[model samples]
Target: MAHMSILLLVISSLLLASTNAHDFIKYGYNGANGADKWGSLSSDFSLCSQGKQQSPININKNTTNYDSNLKQAPRNYVLTKATLINNGINIVLKYDQGAGNLTLDGKIYALTQMIWHSPSEHTIDGQSFPVELQLIHRSSDNHIAVVAILYQYGSPDAFLLQIQDELEQLAKDKCTDEQEARVPVGVVQTRALERRTRKFFRYVGSLTAPPCTEDVAWIILGKVREMTKAQAASLKAPLSAEYQSNARPAQPINGRTVQLYDELHNVKKAPSSKSD
Candidate 1:
């Protein structure tokens, strides 16, 4: 009995240490665990430093190749039940039964979640915007694709305005001791958030966050959308202080081809200077 008790104690200690190690592993947008240190944070995140093809690259209009063969993927988004949650890192809206799917390259990738980043991640001619909305989709084979929309401050976004109340409530809940800050946002119409543009930039890249998984299909809208300053603030209010400005710096293109898909087949002139 004594030997058995000692063996159990040893096993328990090892289990606790394993759990504690996992809990200690954390990443953030600033300070010690910032983007710069992400590569060394864990073995899983080594791709963040070593991957040849990463995301959020500045779309240099002059250098991008115009692919007439490329076309806008069909977006079939519908109203669906969603839950907004402050995932301790960023705000995410998870769909219960998936909002819809985007048909691209002969595959259907289901829209599963949406996330936001302030001060935008991807840049156009090296110019950043006030906000960025990312719609995440996954194919049946577990392939990932992201459609990113950049937003400039202007008239309020109707979709965001509809969820303003829930956002504020989430912000309030985050300040408490509640481990899970999630609210049922009822049925959300994703179509209302769609931008009316056929032009987009496409490339193969990695996930923006840790683990930094590569092979993600990125579709960045060529046209920048508009949203009110207040709406942008509401999106950031629920996140912790460190995450308020959560955007990883643009990664190197590393010889990857960026294809611009436009029906008109005209490349927009690159701005000489950065503007809002």
Candidate 2:
């Protein structure tokens, strides 16, 4: 536990050493994370485009009555056991050890790196949450299962409060003009990523962004974590100029089923804009 100022300074310093925030953190499709380069980075990341998956699905969790028999498998990732490594772009994650496998519907998907997006890239129950962290895990058979969680404005969630403090301390530059920063080694944990309950919405979909790759196991939860407005603002803050809207438009479901554990919950489409 360190002071806020100290953490921010550290992040600034690390990022400044080589790249700047604009390089990866900011929006626009020229540099790393810039949607334009997603295709060239890695073949797997190619799904960033060429996908026909539904974008944001707002969760207005009303029922916990549904029961899901989530087959237990060796966790592909140990949330707390991550080693932070920034590869040119924003920050690239590398696991300290091999993630065995994650079980869902009796299928196992090997653990892959979990990354963060700004201001959230999706919505829930038509109620747009502030942020969304997509945990991408792949199975040995090349199958994929994504556990998606939306951050909202309500009672603060323990994980969000913790991660906020950790990110704020990312290596900050000594000078204001400088860019790029470093986040402490031990920042997030896999344990925290697990939903309070195994109950979730399962659907056959594609990546929300480009490449529009289809056939991804999308597991979205009705649980929305509480985060402060400041925290929400911070996510979108970095990409203000180039990508005030880091989120993409919700793709067409095209007759896809947004289902809950056993029974399916039909989530209707959300209007482009809605008032709270």
Candidate 3:
């Protein structure tokens, strides 16, 4: 019965994605058509305001409960040639089908795409990261799982640097079209997932973006990836002044329980795949 429910949810997500912007309206983080006005923007975005489980929420560790039943699933991501695009709002890297799969709760969800949000939409104890990477995956039946990895200021992050090099090119050219780039998805992604804590905060939430549908499975990693300030600035440079910070404000948890998995200890950081 549970499996059937997940399958049905996935079908709904696909249909929603197809007709999400049926009328073609612009929605953003701020201004006249900002987050606050999303529900009013159009009938399609009503969930952005009405949904009870919106994402990019603040994870208050103090109030969370540890759950040993949560599995530490492995993510087998393949290295692929992805198309990187500056959508004028955020930098998005779109991968081809069969590039990767994340096994969670005994089910495998195929990796779809990844997007960058500066100053992270989600916060920990009210603390925000310099940048956040959201890896999206979808099960064969339509259930969506989002893994949120936070990057802090420290040494340069190899994975980010690789993409950072291309960011400038796209920003300078102001290119709206996708630029082909070979990304080491396997090395970069796996390393991020195999964190020292082997821990994450899991909950049900809506998509951070509009058409904010609910029922998404969110897993936010506890470990923070390090990247130098210059690297962070390079990423934000692509956006216009107003969009320099694309992160949405942390939403309310809405009395939802956030399950934590922190049993795996002494986890070591993986070597950087900088050269790839």
Candidate 4:
């Protein structure tokens, strides 16, 4: 019965990927056909066995711009190394990291690689946000912790633009960049510029990838970033049909509670491929 239910969910996700935007099929999970085999391949994988399924939410809560006056960085974030994957659909740049004294409300956490998801995941009340930056971090005892930032469509961010410009020299795929002299959107388009309003909703969740590991501390940011329509379009500009949309659907939450942090009623707002 569980296998049948999971298969049904897979079919539903396939249908969801059939959005009018584009047709692109995702890789992995059932990449090799057997959905229940990732656990035996590795031991540090429990989300595969215990993960609760959930669909991406529509955040429709506080649209009112509030004073995001929260101050202070974690005082322990260090970017060690960066790994880039330009697969034509979306550029995925990961940073190998270190946390000197990483702490959230005083709890220790270490920096990990970051990933991007279009049309941001966790929603507020019911409205879906546009972009999300998943910063994977770990704690003192070695547990998964993710910081999810939801972005609204607005003006382009300068910090992101800087990173975008830097990636021009490191692109692996020529088809992804139009001019061949500029960086791809994956590096420049998804990022949070707001130093304050770092407050976020906390909960337990799984990785939105194959094996669906559930060992994670999920942090959904109530504050959102801004990017212009033109900037957003540029992200898709370099994307080829292969990398047009590479997002995974949100996993099921079962009957879990979606907790919020420093609730400010703050809210805002990914894709895959066709089975070809």
Best by TM-score: 1
Best by lDDT: 1
* TM-score of candidate 1 to 2 decimals: 0.86
Q: Rate the local accuracy (lDDT) of all candidates.
A: 0.82, 0.52, 0.75, 0.50
TM-score of each: 0.86, 0.60, 0.82, 0.59
Model 1, position 180: C-alpha lDDT score: 53
Instruction: Point out the higher-scoring one by lDDT: 3 or 4.
Output: 3
Tell me, what's the RMSD of every candidate?
6.8, 11.7, 7.4, 12.8
The lDDT of model 4 is 0.50
The residue-by-residue lDDT of candidate 4 on 6-114, one tens digit each, is: 9998986664432111112233233442234444443333444565642343333343223344223343454344555444444445553442334564567766556
User: How close to the true structure is residue 75 of candidate 1, measured as C-alpha lDDT?
Assistant: 82
Candidate 3 stretches with Cα past 4 Å from truth are 1-23, 175-197, 264-276
Model 1, range 1-276, lDDT digits (tens) per residue? Answer: 999999999986664333122233577778899988988998767888999998778999999988877856878898889999887677888899968899889899999998899989999999999898999999999899999999999988887876889999999885433365899999998776553456788999988887788999999987787999889999989877877999999999999999988755545532423211
Q: How close is candidate 3 to the true structure, as a TM-score?
A: 0.82
Of the two candidates 2 and 3, the one with more favorable lDDT, higher being better, is 3
Quick one: how many clashes does candidate 1 have? 0
* Tens digit of per-residue lDDT, candidate 2, span 122-227: 5554556567767777777777677777777766556556556444544232212233344555635555555343345666775554443567787765556677
Which residue ranges in model 4 land beyond 4 Å of their true spot? 1-50, 53-75, 79-81, 87-90, 96-101, 167-194, 233-240, 263-276
